[model samples]
Target chain A: MSKAIITRNLTKRFGDFIATNAITFDVEQGEIFGFLGANGAGKTTAMRMLCGLLKPSSGEATVAGFNIFTQTEQVKRRIGYMSQKFSLYEDLTVKENIRFYGGIYGLSHQQIKSKTEELLGKLQLQQEAGQLVSSLPLGWKQKLSFSIAVLHNPSIVFLDEPTGGVDPITRRQFWDLIYEAADRGVTIFVTTHYMDEAEYCNRISIMVDGKIKALDTPAKLKEQYQAASMNDVFLQLARAKPGENNSSS
Target chain B: MQPIVIENVHKRFGDVKALHDISFSVEQGELFGLIGPDGAGKSTLFRILATLLLADQGSAFVNGLHVVKDYKAIRRQVGYMPGRFSLYQDLTIEENLNFFATIFKTSVEENYDLIKDIYEQIAPFKGRPAGKLSGGMKQKLALCCALVHKPAVLFLDEPTTGVDPVSRKEFWEMLQRLRQKGIPILVSTPYMDEAMLCDRVALIQKGEIMQINTPGNIVKSYGKKIWAMRADNMFRLIRDLRAFEGTDSCFAFGEYLHVTLHVPVEKVQAYLTPLQHGNLVIKPAQPGIEDAFMQLMQEQNETV
Candidate 1:
């Protein structure tokens, strides 16, 4: 029930283009939180800040109890991130890639071995462990990327549109892993353009034109806004654009 | 022979094997959907069938023409809309449509009836550059160009990704209308809900076919009671319910968490007491296509 993420009036500005307007929200420990938005909606910007990759133009935030601005290194050590692209060296075998990433994260050789085996086994990747990362199929790569992201047993993980262009069946598999991790008390923060995926989150926040206009469980937000689905909620806020009312009760 | 037949096909790019032993056929006039994510090999399969790329090992046919041997003939009968908006950015919408039609040895006037419905939606912006139109408008134009020749088979890769909801719905509606013409359409999408709209779907993962069935049969195969529930402390509710011994699998579904209870619903009491006096709600429900996919994945992992 503890807050794993907290942001207070977070803001990001790039040459007067308010990439992320003043926003406030919190994510509880072990919760699967979906960050929903249209393209260019600043979902990426906000996630970058939380991942310790970018600094907020203003405001304050904490991830895993580490100050986002000053203790980013500490925060980085406690979290894992998977980008939209299942980024792994295409030439490296799955096992090598895991070792390299785990090594960079300072995992001990023995620790990396045990974790790799466990992950590979759980993901049904034992048969493909020796295959080059690029040789593996897209669905395999996606699952591998997620496993690598959380390989070090980070307290929280961030996924940036991890299911952007994969099949529904693969996305479903990805979510099952996410759920499995969440069941083990790992907090998950992900951004996705897929409204259906948003429904899988314990709570969701919709960003439009650099501002968060809706935040709640998908149902409450839908009911509160008199919308039917996440898609409707998105359009209702997105079409309102920059000058319209942007907050919900 | 089917309109489109892919037999034990495989494709690779450098070290990346995009498709592996994928085999399926599209019946003439059927709406076939390839449902998968960005890298599920949807594009690779589409390109192979469109004769833009060749499979490494297997054979495929469009209108019973070999994709490799009859590439030229296949090209004339298939229209492909890539995932990205790839029309000439500088060409006006109307110009782009005309150009595409000309490439197929046809004219806008010749196929006006075929594309008239979609074309009308963006007609106002026809004189504007293809890049200048909104995402939805651009999508409509792409469809028009693809249909200008009225090919017997059409290929659309991730056609609705990043587009607005209304436009997504409208685009699908247009596809439905096109189905009336008896053209076998092959569309790819990462979204599960859209799978229901297709007459049949091929669910792929890691470049392999997972299942191929009509949407209705797929739903019928999922025999689980899903319940959606929520309360004031939604986060707390999600955790407590997930932890309860009898709970099978719980996921956030819209406003409530879709949960599977091993115990009877009337038995909501034994666990309801601990959750009582707390701000939460509980109820039983049904599974959507997405839910069924999750269960299948879960089952696959347990056995694998």
Candidate 2:
């Protein structure tokens, strides 16, 4: 499989502080990669750099085979990004939000109209298409936001804590949607605080302080760490003292 | 009287019913958790108990003081930490704690013993502005400020919502210490796993309390045989299990799909074996707090 993301010594520095310290990894095409880390562990900094929202201070990286430095726009175009804080407009109707994102992605009017209809049908939101996004339940709103994120069919999608504060069943339903997208060959690079969700990833990278401390399939990481669950594995890796096992692959 | 008593309290915002006849009580020195997802009225109930908002109907008591009639007395006796970080952004950590202490007609020195353990963790950053601290540090400072006055009871709303697992564990440990210190704590969280750490948890959803019991009792009383099933294609497995006639409910839980059956496990295995699922594994699984919560929510949804 072709590589969806590649980085060699990716580093981002904020003045004297090194927020992301020369991290290196690759995500394969259609792979569901979980980026795990504690708060202020440079997960966001690394994600921002890969998403082309922030410039790296040093090293090399490419997303969707495009250089993050010189081909930033190309990288951004080939990736769909959704964050819990900001995704859809509450005031806009479901269909309107779809049109807005579709237009922003430079889709033609004909394409946007067809995609909106198709999305509404698949999500069974044909009835809700005319209603304001705010009127829908939290689960429906999140699913709608995700559908709109991928309406333009980008090769890769980045989800930042997409299931935060959602109910259990709905959280699983959201994962089902993610699985469907991944089945269609859309690479998923996601970050989450929920460890159970981390288990759904094909592979995971746990960041501590500014480096990738552990990166592997969750089963292998569990075996290596002698953990029964992903939560235990996360606590062990995140609580490890700095300079303890600097690298694990 | 219980340290905290909520009797059929009801709260609504315009057309939306935020809390519907919510009633629960916390014994002295108990660490009680209100477990639910966002928009489940946990914060509304907390605000009513904190005397920050009035209930539309029914009543609540904190330390035997009426929430509505004795709002002033309740305010002085209860330490409330709202879900959002509400400390003075421009003030240093020490300043915030001192400010809270002063408002309660007490000084940090007067109740220093009450907050010593938690405060020491953040004391090194006492000079830092409240807004400058990291998420975990801010949480610690907030706990210290909440404890500085040494109120009769404590109300923490979603104290560990967005915090990482390590920090969340530490925060819960702090709560456990506080419980041992003989203060009743009414904390709320969206995470179901945290419910097990509490003395008892009230499973809430959509403006109503579904059940209130010890987390262990809640799981034991799930009243269904749950099975853990997994295959090479988990997504398809969930769909197939949900489509099965004998399946009552199926949900993705970590590495396996936790399923409740109407028939037998042998039947489920027999049904799925023909589907060409690679490396399928099926075994009886214990129901957890989340599983119980989901079951209750489903039953509630069906009834409504």
Candidate 3:
């Protein structure tokens, strides 16, 4: 299988601080890859670089078979992105939001019209097509945002903490959509704070202070760390940081 | 003695009922958790118990003081950390703590023992503005300010939400220490996994109590045959499982689809024998808090 993402000594620096230091990893095509890290562990910086939103200070990387630095526009066009903060027009209706996004991706007028209808049908939101996006429930909005992200049929999709405050049932359904997309050969790269969600990925990379501390499948990581769960494995790695305070836990 | 007691609390805003006839109690020194997702009325209930809002009906008492009648006294005895960060962003870390301490007619030195462990972590950056701190540091500071007064009961509303996994783990450890000091803690979280850390948890939804018990007991009461299942095409697998006659409910859990069935495991195997899928695996699985919560939610929906 071809690699969906590749990074060789990918590094990003801000002033004197090295936010992402010499990180290297590859995500297989159609695989769900979990990127785990603490708040300041440079997960976002690395993701920004991969998404072509931020330039890497050094090192080499490719996303969706395109070099992030040299072919930034090509990389952007080939990937879908979603974030914890919902980025839809609250004032717009559900159908209007879908059309707006579809247009942004440069779909033809005919293509946008059909895609909008298809999305509404898939999410079972045909009844609410004329309703404001803000009036919908949180779960519905989340599902809609995800569907919109992949509306252009990108090869890879990047989700950053996509299920932050959703209910258990909604989260369960959202994962189903993710599984559906992955089955259709869409590679998934996601960052999340929930340890349980981390187990859903085919492989996980745990980053600490701009470095990839542990990268492996959940089962293998558990065995290597002698941990009962992903949560324990994370705690073990986080505690190993040099001169780290707040170690009582 | 009970540090907190809430009886038949009800609240509504316009046509929407924020909370409904909620009642529970917290023992002295016990770390009690209110577990639910957003829009579950967890915050509404927290505000009422913290003496920040009044309920339409029912009564709440902290240290035997009524929430409405003795609101002033209760305020002095309960330390409330709202769901959102409410600390003075313009002030330095030390200044923020001192300001809170002064408001409670106390000094940082008076409660130094209570907050020393948490405060010291961010003490190095004590001179920095609160708004400039990292997410984890801001959380520690917020927790420190909450404890600066050394109140008898601590009310932390979703203290770990949006916090990194590492810091969340550490925050729970700090809560354990606070409980050891005989300070009762009333914490709330949307994360179901954190419920297991509490001595007792009240699984709440839309202002009503779904179940109140130890996390272990809740899981024990699930009493269903669940299988952790996966196949080459998970999407098709879920559809097929739902169509199977024996399936009671099917929901995705991480990489596996958790299916609770009415029939035996052997029957499920027989059903999958001729399925047009590859790499199918099914095994008997233990139910967790999330599964139990989902089951309860499903039952609640069916009844409604």
Model 1: per-residue Cα lDDT at residue B179: 95
Q: Write model 2 residue lDDT over A1-249, tens digit each, in one string.
A: 899999999999877878899999999999999999987788888999999999999999999999998899999999999888767999999999999999999999999989998999989999988999988888888898889888889999999899989888889889999999998999999999899999999999999889999999989999999999999999998883422221111
**Model 2 C-alpha lDDT per residue in residues B1-304, reported as the tens digit of each score:** 7999989998888889889988888998899999999899999998888988889899999999998899998888888999999999889989999899888889999999988887877777788788877677778888888888888999999998778888899899889988999999999998989999999999999999999999999999999988998998888898899899999988888988899889978998899989999999998898899999999999999999
Error of 2 at B254 (Å): 0.4
Q: For model 3, report the TM-score of its A chain.
A: 0.95
Instruction: Give the clash count for each candidate.
Output: 11, 0, 0
List RMSD in Å for every model shown.
5.9, 2.6, 2.7
Deviation of model 3 at B11, angstroms: 2.3
Model 1 iRMS: 7.2
Across A68-152, the per-residue lDDT of candidate 1 in tens digits comes to 9999999999999998666799999999999999998999989999989998899888998898997776778889999999998
Can you write out model 1's per-residue Cα lDDT over B1-304, one digit (the tens) per residue?
6899989998887767689899998997999998866676888888888888878898988898888899998888888899888999899988999899889999999989999888877786667887766666778889899899988888999889876455577789999999998888999987888999999998776577777999898888888888777666555566677678888887765466678889876665567666663655666676777777767766755765
What lDDT score goes with residue B48 in model 2? 88
Ranking by lDDT: 2, 3, 1
DockQ of each: 0.20, 0.49, 0.46
- What RMSD does model 3 have? 2.7
